[model samples]
Target: MVESLPQTRSVSAEAAAENRAWVSDLSSTGDRRELASRRLYDVLLRAARSEAGRRAARLRLAGPELDDIAHQAAADALLAICGKVETFRGDCKFTTWAYKFVIFDVGAKVNRHFWQRAGVAFDEEDWERLPARLGVGPEAHAESRDLMAAVRRAVDETLTAKQRTVFVALVLNGMPTDVLAEQLGATQNAIYKTMFDARRKLRTALIAAGYLQEHQPA
Candidate 1:
């Protein structure tokens, strides 16, 4: 009775009934579940396509690429929805809850697609441009030279090879973490961890060298 009260208070009767119907259809065996799955995928595909189209310009993707991302998102979202359907509590209509999965998948897939399409290449020339990339103007180079030199020294002296690569690619080169992850054949979390360790080491070195105060942000 208490559980029923919560559902009644939170979900309209129509929404609750619709949610139950969706759950039942999805949970059924054989033909019924197959048909329901197809319908749900179609709904998710349309939503993903809309989102992909909207993001096409920013992602530098054309129609075929956008359609590919949309299809991948919809397929992944369907698997996610099926796996997590038991977590649904009828707080809203089932379709609404399901659409959230598609939206999230679209975002992740889009990031992956963008990173794969846009390469992050780091070279010695890019290394030399660090001062410019960090917004240290030529006029201010003399004033900021010590700080930049300290950062370079710290990076070379304090960090491991992998950490240095991740730091240079992600921080100095303005490469997206996803792009770095793809290039390095690593996970984004792993790339982030490497960057974190690199920053911590650099912060310690700069603080010790008197270039950065202990209170300054890393």
Candidate 2:
């Protein structure tokens, strides 16, 4: 059994065969690679459109604009996937892994679209969202003000400048990770990882400073 994959959702033999064929065709030379790429591009386009469809209403982008986002996402995903073809290990289905690429591009595109639609700029004013998440209340912690102050310091002093920017933009300003990534000229994966590290640092600082109540995961 693959430790990373649950046995419950086993990849059937037929599915595995198809995945292998995708790899073979995609990794082929000349015309084969071209044809395979076109096929994969179509699949990616559909996946991106589906992704956009799921969020069109929330992003308030529909009709041609949403389709345009999906098209751009598919093109981006195709380039990324083809450029990194050697990295496909076949641990998961080819389609499954490729889907992630499409999702990443689509997510970034959608996030930027949403941000543009909402006019959410990352500013000092956005920091307002952090304080509420940090403090419980006057009754929960007598030194709520100090705890909040400590959290602010932790945010400023503990995280790297980039980390601080990403966290503040995404959390406080309600800017999506993808949009923050675009503004920072970074990938969504990189921004998310930075956010993860920043959150861990903040959690430790908050717990140490007597702000958040720590509870072990069950």
Clashes of each: 0, 0
Residue 69 accuracy (lDDT) in model 2:
95
Query: Can you write out model 2's per-residue Cα lDDT over 99-188, one digit (the tens) per residue?
Result: 999998887877666545533343343444456554444454466557556867897789987776676667664676656876668999
- In model 1, pairs of residues that clash are none
Which stretches in model 1 have alpha-carbon errors above 4 Å?
1-6, 119-189, 193-218
**Candidate 1 lDDT trough over 10 residues, lowest sum:** 1-10
In model 2, state the lDDT of residue 45.
94
lDDT digits (tens) for residues 179-211 of candidate 1: 678767899999988988888888788779876
Q: Report the lDDT of model 2 for residue 27.
A: 67
RMSD to the hidden true structure, all candidates: 7.6, 9.3
